[model samples]
Target chain A: MKGMSIIVKKVAQLISGLIFLYGIYIITHGHLTPGGGFAGGAIIAGAYILNILAFGSDAMNLKNKEQGSSLSESLAIFIVLMLAVFALFIGSKIFFANYLPKGQLGEIISAGAIPLYNIFIGIEVAAAIITIFLALVIFKEEVKK
Target chain B: MNSLIPLFVIVPLATSFLIMILGKFINGFQKTITPLVLLFLTVLSFYCLLNNHSNSYTYAIGGWEPIDNIPIAIYFVMDGFSLILLCIISLIGFLASVYSISYIAKFTSENNFYSLLCLMITGMSGVVLSGDLFNLFVFLEISVISSYALVAFGTEKEELEASFKYQVLGGIASFIILFAIGLIYWRTKTLNIADISALFHSHETSTFDLFIQILLISGFGLKAAMMPFHAWLPDAHSSAPSPISAMLSGVLIKAVGIYVIIRLFFTMFIVSEEISLLITTLGTISMVIGVLLAIGQWDIKRLLAYHSISQMGYVVLSIGIGLVLLARGVKPTVATLAIAGGLFHMVNHAVFKGLLFLNAGAIEHRINTRNLKEMGGLSKHMPVTSGTSFIASMAISGIPPFNGFFSKLIIIIAAVQAKFYLVAFLAVFVSVITLASFLKFQRYAFYNKSEHRSTSKIKEVPFPMLFSMIVMGILCLAFSLLAFPGIREQILGPAIDVLTNPNQYVQTIIGI
Candidate 1:
């Protein structure tokens, strides 16, 4: 449960922000690029996991963060589901219809609702992985106790 | 009409997430919202049934309709078969949720339980409604994962062990299914069931197709817990909470396992005589062996779990016979009868088996025991549980005037008409053995004097549990009216029609 060597901790702190930024970049470019929500979310989770590895459990208060992450994950999934349901109400189209206007091709804001869906999935997947990681950490701590 | 298809999956999925988010802060929100969502789904499914009226339709999600006669979007197909499955899932889901309102009180983290339950429902509804094979796999994972968590919810040593076994087997089953899906996609260049069916129909059958079929049967057979692939079911069903056990035995296996097998074999792939015989042989083995195993069990829930395999065997056997007759080009009417028999038995099993598990839960809730040897004279103190359990027991045993008898009779008559005389004999024989086992259940649990002296504090379960059991008990008798021609035409006829004509299914979707 102790923090890693001071050198390792300093290095992790210096690089974790870049990892977070890269994850955001992948999520935003999801509609036009190869790495979408799942890959990007995993990268985001990895950054947080790195922070935990360097700073120790007490530094992040992982138990409380896990609760927050789980709630956010649920909220993200809700947003995704609501987007689909919103289709049914707005137009004569079927469920998950691309009701939003197609802005353009090969752009961040294009492809109707695809980017929006990707962002929601990104949030959900990121939060879910972090929660799982924190839960395992908490479980191990409890067992040690 | 096409627009309504998504609600089956959406309502449960949305409610699940909502419950998880809000349930922590809002005391008792999980209990209230879970039942309300399921009840709404029940009404919606019945609405779907009434409106469908022998018609089949497909909804293209994201409005990406077919291009140049090839489907490019994910499709949700609602036909007689899916609609029937939808009704079963929703009705049982509603009843189980109601039962859980009281039953789940003993467990902490009620929010987690409700969330997982809703997710399971969403998975099942999605499985039945999906027109794409890959989408089916996704939903199947959703349900299976939640169920694994549910099975281990109690966190007892036995529950954890059972859940571990379930997860390993379930994982392998998913892998096999995914491998087979890869083969299918490799061959047909499509994931849509209707598109794949059309493609297969135009070309002559290949040995690779047969290979894929074998993989599919084994994979789905594992999920269905057929005789050869039934190791996880007894442990998983018995170790879980009673309401969960009811859901697993009543609808989950039928929804994800048997239902998928029936849909794929009948509608997606070409049914051949050899395949039909293979399926029938498996069904018969499960039927005989499952009951044989049940008779020796002391744990009431474990005994009922074994019978789930046996009753599911009855369903698969009848349907297999129907397939054989259809494949052999003989006795079309008799084949239709066989299919109808199977479908009716399926619905009947869901009702009675669900009631039985709920009964088991009620007894356990009151007495804190699952061993029949420890329970006795419960008919005096808990009249509702005892009476409802009796009705369920009689119904499952194929006693006359109950729903089970009519469906069993139809199956036997159909078997005889189809000239499978041995099958008819075995069907009747299994019914008898089933009766004997239930009599044992009745005697030990309700009739005999208590072997232990701690029976002083036993009482009836709470009102919600009692209410659900009573409703299911009434349905046990009510569903028997399906034996009539007028009723059969409305409820089971279209489903049989859809199964009998695979070409019709393809055409309905592709409009060719």
Candidate 2:
């Protein structure tokens, strides 16, 4: 059982990583495309769920999951907020404007502030979803046991 | 200031998940950790509120800018109104967490309870802070989905039934709201509220516009538990845990229903005379019928739940009167007063009604029953519960020196000034009946000498629960200070301004 679980864990981890990378792609291209932070983050969380299932109830530590996800989520949201404040400080009136120099459109680094905001949202959503499921997994085991 | 916007949603969202994870690894961890985290977030949010005086802060997704005066990205805006509502959400959330410390001890899964609680708060916070309409819908879904699950947490027959009913109504509301969003997007090809408002301002009137308005009213009205859409409130509010009930009754409906309605109608869309009159009619009908229903209830929570509908009716009626005056271009100051009264009453309800629910929870906690007939002479064994309930009861009944009285006074004064004599009379009449009904509660549940006293032994609830009740009772008194001079201008004035002149909100957020 342990050997099979390890094999399953390795495969799931590989798949989850691929999905996470895909989420990053989606978030970065959010402005020019259909997908953004929420959709990508949900996908990333799906990866975390898969990993936990493979490893069983004790696979992930709830405390670490909670601490890590909250910090990341807070940081991501804060980053987006700080950017808006920066615009105010610099003489821009409205929030979420493109503060950066607009590069050539359709490039990997284009859309100015759009890519950056997507990155932050992607991080927050992914972490929040993971924390939610991990908390549920851990709590259910404790209740059952 | 803009940098702080995401923290409003992120802090609670992350903390809730964290508590769930911690609960999995450690025994009894959630009971302590969840409340502590919530308290920390509440303090942080209050700090933010104090610093955020009169500026509207907006956060854009991916830092996207409009290419040709067209918004192509999601944005979040927080102004005086959203900030005030945010403070209320955090304040009530913190107290509910504190109350839950002991209240949830009887429940089987502390972790799940905390998780749903956090999710609900996250959704509410997100809704308040969201700048885009679609984003609001997403957060709205987050909050409602968790709330549906929370309502049925007990898994009893009635609970499941209530959850099912709530979900059906909730789903329909969501469907209508989505279709409204689709219509607005279909017309303007934009989902941003400011952009939509700007679009509608330049465009000619159409039937599609009216259709969208009706759809939104129904959608948010159902969530707000307005009279016509209030079928699910009595069951949904009474069936949840006390703290959760406090949340649903005190904060959830306001955030999702009335708050959204106010934000959309006042800020995002124009309020026509027809719409304003419709709102007044809904408010008056709900006020009379909700109280009439409550007078006959034996279930303690159900009675409070029905009152939630009636009290909310007071809020809608007051605000609707303000809207009617605004539409007619009549005495602007008196209309502003009416709006302020309604908004003040919203805040007061959060405090006193929330306290009343917690008090009911304490009674139910000690005796294991919510049937008013099954409870008698509780004051002898639980002085703190009895005292606090008396304070909350007095406050809700509009007695002097409590927060509820000032708001009700303002509403009555506003009603009379506007020449709505019948409304003024009915408002006063309802206040009296509310007093009588609460007196019934005090007589039967707390003070009346009864047979249960001789046979069964009861005691004051554990410290955490009592501590929450006492704090809420104190707020019921302290918040009345808003009726005084400085605080009203500093806090309430800005909120009233945001609603009265919706253009100021768009300009401020767009950095005019």
Best by DockQ: 1
lDDT tens digits by residue: candidate 2, B71-94: 666777887778778888888988
Ten contiguous residues minimizing lDDT sum, candidate 1 chain B:
B48-57
Candidate 1: misplaced stretches above 4 Å?
A: none
Per-residue lDDT, model 1, residue B262, is 94
TM-score of 2: 0.82
Give residue B126's lDDT in candidate 2 (0 to 100). Answer: 92
User: Each candidate's TM vs. the true structure?
Assistant: 0.99, 0.82
* Per-residue alpha-carbon lDDT of candidate 2 for residues A1-145, written as tens digits (9 for 90 to 100): 0123567878987898898788777787787889998888888778777776777655446677776886676567656666654564453544445677778877878776777778778888888787787677667767877
